[model samples]
Target: MDTERLFDRSYERVLSHEVDGRAFFEGFYDAFLAASDEVAEKFHDTDMDRQQAMLMKSFYHLLSFYASNNADYYLDRVAISHNRHHINIRPALYDLWLDTLILTVRRFDPECCDETELAWRLVMTPGIVYMKFHYNRDSIVGS
Candidate 1:
């Protein structure tokens, strides 16, 4: 699946009226909550602390900043903050996150699985790397 096709499909899915932002968020939130538990169990750690939950919420907000008026500034600020504050970004957690996202998208639009999977892989691969790099850099610098 090429990028253009994938994006087109994503756009189509977005405009289909079958998939709403609220539904996406609700699905994502539920998936994240479930993944958090799996993460804790897999790592022998506890559920995410309040601080972690707050941080995750902020990340979601940052992702949505593109829909706002000051999108560029908001995006830049989000990137900077991710670079400065998210030090302990875990790959396993991210895998779980992506899984959740995929599941959510599939739940909403089963027909778009192939396109969604391709789009998500395209978007998330670079995103995860960028996030992890900044997060690790932040940890080292902050410490």
Candidate 2:
């Protein structure tokens, strides 16, 4: 099975009205924030409306990056902004982020299974790794 196609199928189900629009993201952030105090503190000043919108766009970039293995303009922007010079997201936080996302997927997607969840992780991990790789390398790359 194609990971991207399968992942997209499951993700679309979670996003559709049947599951409630924005509900998945809301749950993801709620769980993600609650998973760690650092995560909560990082988002304490954030405008979630905007953050969710960004995340909505980001998922596509993640899928795209995974499918193409190329950090396109949008993905590059995401990496640069989150690099050490900017938001400075810790590498350790990504594990919590992915776990929270998969947990939310299980909660929101009625059809979710081990394969479905693995698809999500497989599709999202490259982008997560990209973000983490750029964290300290921002200096050499000129973020």
The whole-model C-alpha lDDT of candidate 2 against the native structure comes to 0.85
RMSD of 1: 7.0
lDDT of model 2, residue 81:
81
Model 1 collision count: 0
Q: Which candidate is the best by TM-score?
A: 2
What's the CA error at residue 15 for candidate 2, in Å?
Answer: 0.4
- Score each candidate by Cα lDDT: 0.54, 0.85
TM-score of 1: 0.56
Steric overlap count per candidate: 0, 0
For candidate 1, write residues 53-115 as lDDT tens digits: 555565454444422423344334444565535434455666777787777667666566676
Worst lDDT run of 10 residues, candidate 2, spans 15-24
In candidate 2, position 15 carries an lDDT of 84
Worst 10 residues of 1 by lDDT: 66-75
Query: Could you give candidate 2's per-residue lDDT for residues 1-143 as a string of tens digits?
Result: 77777798898888862344458888789889989999899999899989999999998888888888888888888787888789988888888899999999998888899999989999899999988888887442544
